[model samples]
Target: MNCKSLQPAAKKCVNEDCELHEKGFAKYFCNICNLFDDRPRPIFHCPYCNTCRMGLGLGIDFRHCMRCNACVSLADKDHRCIPQKLQGSCPICHDTLFNSTEPLKGLRCGHVMHLSCYNQYCRGQNYTCPLCMRCMEDMSDYFSLLDQAVRMQAMPAAYQNTICNIYCQDCEKTGECRYHFVGLKCTQCASYNTREMGRYEQLAAFPN
Candidate 1:
């Protein structure tokens, strides 16, 4: 079997007579670099990561983040830094993230997860990071729509003037807002992704 033809293939060589047929042909094989290589892009061994990675070589298309202990794309150079963010598994699927072959995505909260998992998670209407409970993307437009909806529907008379102590997951702040069955808006960031802590009281109860 011609080894050149299998240079770009990731599957094992099927030539029955070939000695290495069972071993297969790896496009990114580097005998001197590492024993096993499965990365999609051009393979380069990262000393800090102690494994093979796909990129234009370190310091070119990627850089090793000491804090995260992983190689990150140059495009994410200015991303929010989280301590040992890549050391954990994907929050959605619980798959290892450190050496995963799948594409990784960085959340706004500085958490990391598999790109595919992130897509599936978002399709479920979950917009927050699983670990931090913070918004994964800009939710201002969605929150604005919720604001309009809240304004259009008045609360029932029994619950009117009632307030709730809430915690804003996006801004990580605590404040009070008028209780609504739809959602509670944060007083600080105007975000509706809040959790009700407890009821404040009806303003009419202490009327002047």
Candidate 2:
């Protein structure tokens, strides 16, 4: 559409409802989408996405992942299947991640986290999901290290026979095992984040 023709000498249009009457095509604008074009080339807006997108002559082929609650490449529909609903804060940063403006990094276990938060986490030594104990990506080296540690180390004589109740974060199972300085190991999944429970306290999964 010829936006210049819409801008009268009075810097307004006869149609008061038209947004261009107030601001006529500032630099590069799309009358159809009613947004400033950020790219050097023309862009189109997907009503479903409610955001601008880029494409060649054919048009962008992005698809929204309902589970992820975000737009993804058309070819990448088979993402890690998260059975639960997408809601609440990020497991890593404790910030609202669902329906957030920031891009997300989906894990194989079906949980989604901020891309920036994930990058920052990768800078550390560990490589496991913060919410679940499942490995976020390939951690064969880390797993091997843990295996060697478990094999080479032994519990102290004092705590060697003391039985303790524990809960597994990954498998959501409970079992009893001997305690050690390293950590309480879950008999189910071998995750060390298990918490010791008192005789009165019933076994329960940690709050998500």
Candidate 3:
């Protein structure tokens, strides 16, 4: 059988372990495995991924997440797991996360994204997971403040009964809510950033 089309008219290896032995092509045959190639970086063959991945066992600051099927930073070893989370595009920038050379950051929600993209997203005053809409950090204190402000009716009565179209900074969803004496809550994520598209109206108090 002629195995000419496998690689080019290159040198052939007779070793049975060599991948090019049966194919009859050998460019840079490894004496051990006998396969064509000049690998530059430290390529670590992942048995799980069934492929060679660069930057392993070379003082690389990352750990392979078996659940995500990708390498995440060592700092994120304790991050939550979302099965096959890193297999697709990032939720923040919608860019492919796998095999990317950019710096990646794993969220508490088990999602990962480009570090720069995540920084820019948070710079826009959002502090929640873009995919799950869960608070990235514990904001129970802030929520308590909001709750207190509502109980005390700290907002001026002039703002009462106002109709506001709220866009949640956390969830990126929109809804309309009637203004109260304190804060307007988003119907979607219940976030208090209901400051968008506000319209004032004179809603009279209901008679008891």
Candidate 4:
């Protein structure tokens, strides 16, 4: 049924001998089915979702996203869209995200996770989206510090010219960089968020 046609149940019951009428339990009435309920006030039925949801009403606090097939906050109308983004489980907790009551946070990569989970994950020093392994926030300052640290450290005599293959999570590219125990910087983006593929080949040792 269209949500506009669904009316709030009546507050009082007309049945004289009904238990709800005697105890004043009937506080809402479903106009379509002629049923009374004591659930709560301000409940709304969403035609798009085809379910009764607790909120201020559709288009007031939230709106339905046809692409995601879920109701999202009105404030997030311009949020980045990922195909069926809300239809998956939280990456951290592995709990269902659709219709979940917990607050959610969206990442730059267009991934979503429970707000609490995001906080805990950040507190654990993880700054990338778990699903895509992409940097979730600007890491320019952090990467600059790594650059300074790498510059100050000198490689051992035997490995001075050593180079290694690395795949960068930030740039999503594979390249080679001078081998350093601190971290391998992406040759393309100069980001230290990279993993060594393996030691390439050793060359003539040279001073840094």
- Number of the top-ranking candidate, with TM-score as the measure: 1
TM-score of each: 0.78, 0.57, 0.49, 0.68
lDDT of 2: 0.61
- Kindly list the per-residue Cα lDDT of model 4 for residues 84-182, writing each as its tens digit: 887789999999987776778888778899999999999999988999998887789998998888889887866777888889987889987889888
Backbone clashes in candidate 1 total 1
Of the candidates numbered 3 and 4, which has the greater TM-score value?
A: 4
User: Candidate 2 or 4, higher TM-score?
Assistant: 4
Q: lDDT of each model, Cα atoms only?
A: 0.80, 0.61, 0.64, 0.75
Clashing pairs in 3: none
Of 1 and 4, the candidate ranking higher by TM-score: 1
Sort order, lDDT high to low: 1, 4, 3, 2
Query: In candidate 4, which residue ranges exceed 4 Å CA deviation?
Result: 1-65, 70-78, 202-208
Q: List model 3 lDDT by residue over 1-208, tens digit each.
A: 2433444334464455666566645324433333345545544544565544454531365566787777655655467878887678978768888756577777766778888988999899887777876667666578779877777764466665567667776567888776665666777766775456766574665211
Clash counts for all predictions: 1, 0, 0, 3
lDDT score of residue 121 within candidate 1: 91
TM-score of 1: 0.78
* Cα-lDDT of candidate 3: 0.64
Model 1, residue 21: what's the lDDT?
Answer: 71
C-alpha positional error of residue 127 in candidate 1 after TM-score superposition, expressed in Å:
1.0
Query: Candidate 2 lDDT, tens digit per residue, 91-145?
Result: 7788876446577787767777888999998899656788776667754465467
